[model samples]
Target: MSLSTVQQVLARIYTDSKLRDDFLTNPDVVGISFGLNCQEIQQLSKLSRQQVDLFARSLKRKRLGEIRKLLPLTNQALGKEFNPLFFQYSETYLPTGNKKHLLDAIAFTKFLLQQLTTDNTQPVSVLDVLRYEAVRLKMFEGKRLLFCNRFYYHLETLINSLHSDSPLIPYPQPNIGIWFRLPNSQWRSLFIPFSVKRKKIFSFHRLVQKYLAIQ
Candidate 1:
């Protein structure tokens, strides 16, 4: 039998939370509205909402796990604030990129930043941490990032404060920042004072060495 119609209905099931709930409560009626014919309705109505919810929750947890692996500092800095934002983000945005988790993590950070600003949020260090990490993650993937050369000190305090449960103390002056992963798979942030041209080249060389070593 042709499965395309059922497949489309199932796609909606996964993407629409409200539809999922309605379908869970009354698949017989709900399936009718989703292009499901009598046979399709009969087959889909047999689906167990309990099992579906369990699987959905598992998928959510797994996605969060992937984000945590990529953005450890941002995850920790937000504490409980991370969950709701992540949930909304995952439900609303479907990422399309080759570097799936990395791209998703970066997109999630941007999503949170947009929401916070939209809500007229108070000064949140967590947002700062996320902005920092998102850029750093790009650098970690070998992308070159240039900044105003003034946000240096602020970046230092932000990176240092990621694991702390307090807001970042903004530095007195405007600052600049550059960050890359170390050989140990640990993040290392460097400012212009210490991140000279030679140091920057050396740091990138180390990135290649680590990649080669891993291979």
Candidate 2:
């Protein structure tokens, strides 16, 4: 019932394999409560109207049964007061390879969660994830490569230069991969694994606060 509990529930849902699978496989799960209009959802999903219709058709009664099983595990902390508009915004800005779209998706998800939870203390929202993703994708040349051990020393300097007031957080600058622009004008980078435990969220939040302080 509390905000922390709600976040935990959502986190569990995020990590739930069965829920993720069901979400992707079920057409019914796609349309309901998306907070977006049909046209908007179509545009965001990059699917034509016919494709959306076909996808919607796949949501049979049998699949709903599967989602029902998981529904009771959480106390519907999502609340019963569902707004079609929220889903419209959420569904209309679906994640895509497009940088603009992805950034919008992350920001909108954060906003929706903020609205639902009404808690400001643990401000780890989709925006944090987006920031992490952006930092993960950022490319630096020469001695600034800090994503890996080969240049760990350089990473410390780059981070120190952040001055606890810089807009950028201190992420390891070294990565194993190169960056390139995709056909869609979105930037892509294939890098070695960058692990983020729960603690990093707090660290990033602090970084955000520190950045905001000087501004």
List of clashing residue pairs for candidate 1: 150-174, 150-175, 150-176, 151-175, 151-176, 152-175, 152-176
Clashes of each: 7, 12
TM-score of 2: 0.20
Error of 1 at 105 (Å): 1.4
lDDT of 2 by residue, 76-157 (tens): 2222322332344443332323353334433544554455446443223222322333344332212233222122112333
Taken over the whole model, the C-alpha lDDT of each candidate is 0.67, 0.35
Candidate 2 segments whose C-alpha is farther than 4 A from its true place: 1-51, 56-76, 81-86, 98-105, 113-215
- 86-195 in candidate 1: lDDT tens per residue? 98898876554578678788788778879887886635555666677777667655655432222334555776765465555655333344454545466555444444
